[model samples]
Target: MSDGYSLTVELTRGGDSNNRDKMRATVEADTVDELREKVDALRDEMQEWADDFRNIQPEYRRELPDDQSQLGEVQA
Candidate 1:
């Protein structure tokens, strides 16, 4: 008598079920509607993370010369 539903998924690239990654979890709820709401919330949180990751940028700067003689003076 299980009160919750269990889900197990395996992902394979080349049709080899044995050589794949697996994820298993159980969702507990009083009703099917509750389960759907929980799953949708999870989806929304994942989407937020994806949106944040898309905004990454690199900072760039030029290195100063180690030798003072090699450095050039700035013009006004």
Candidate 2:
């Protein structure tokens, strides 16, 4: 077969027949260089999502300690 991918999924119901599906994809690239390009694009998308979580999230702040300093120490 040509350079391609095939995915098959099957689901079965309770006490009944089974359902099957098959998907086939073909890439016209003759070498691995084209495949690497596709992988790089996916990586960039994932990095952008991670940056939003780390930098844009409001919970990523430094809070004061929750010790008794806020209420002042009790005199002996």
Candidate 3:
């Protein structure tokens, strides 16, 4: 018996023309725990892409919380 999952993640470019970014990947594992590990790895990769996008477009970047949460919230 074999257990595995095939998933696709998509992202949209923010600009004049909207373009699609498609990422197709597969995770093969014998157990659920192993599958979770594989999924976490995939999630990390997606997060890196998001970080890169924020870096490229300063206007769409999200503000980070500072030591003074109240002040940061107010500024935002």
Candidate 4:
């Protein structure tokens, strides 16, 4: 007979703010060492994803003229 071990891992980015990202995985192994290895791999994957996410730039909307009468004027 053999023993089985299962683990669940969750990683999150920007936890302090409203915009947040999360990653989760479940790993299983016959030994504690194997379980730890699987969890490490999952953590590495999550970290890579977080690094990539950090490189992305936020989009902003273009601002319009504040004066309503100037809206009809053409630019040179």
Clashes of 1: 0
Candidate 3 per-residue lDDT, tens place, 1-76, comes to 3455544455554455443344456666677787788878988987788667556633566555665555435653
Q: Output the number of the lDDT-best candidate.
A: 4
Q: Candidate 1: where is the Cα deviation over 4 Å?
A: 6-28, 57-76
What tens-digit string does per-residue lDDT give for candidate 2 at 1-76? 3764323222222342332222223333445676556545545654565455345433455555666554356455
Instruction: Let me know the TM-score candidate 1 reaches against the reference structure.
Output: 0.39
RMSD of 3: 13.6
lDDT of 4 by residue, 1-76 (tens): 1579998887777855656777778899999999899988888888898898877766976666666455457576
- The numbered model that scores best in TM-score is 4
Q: Write the per-residue lDDT of candidate 1 for residues 13-68, one digit (tens) a residue.
A: 32455433333334456677877877666657556654554454446667666654
Task: Give the clashing pairs for model 3.
Answer: none
* Model 4 TM-score on a 0 to 1 scale: 0.64
lDDT, residue 10, candidate 4: 78
Error of 3 at 34 (Å): 0.5
Please state the error at residue 24 of candidate 4 in Å.
1.1
TM-scores of all predicted structures: 0.39, 0.32, 0.44, 0.64
Superposed Cα deviation of residue 49, candidate 2 (Å): 1.0
Q: How displaced is residue 22 in candidate 2, in Å?
A: 28
- Candidate 3 runs further than 4 Å off: 1-18, 50-76
Residue 11, candidate 2: C-alpha displacement in angstroms:
28
Clashes of each: 0, 0, 0, 0
**Reference-based lDDT, residue 63, model 2:** 52
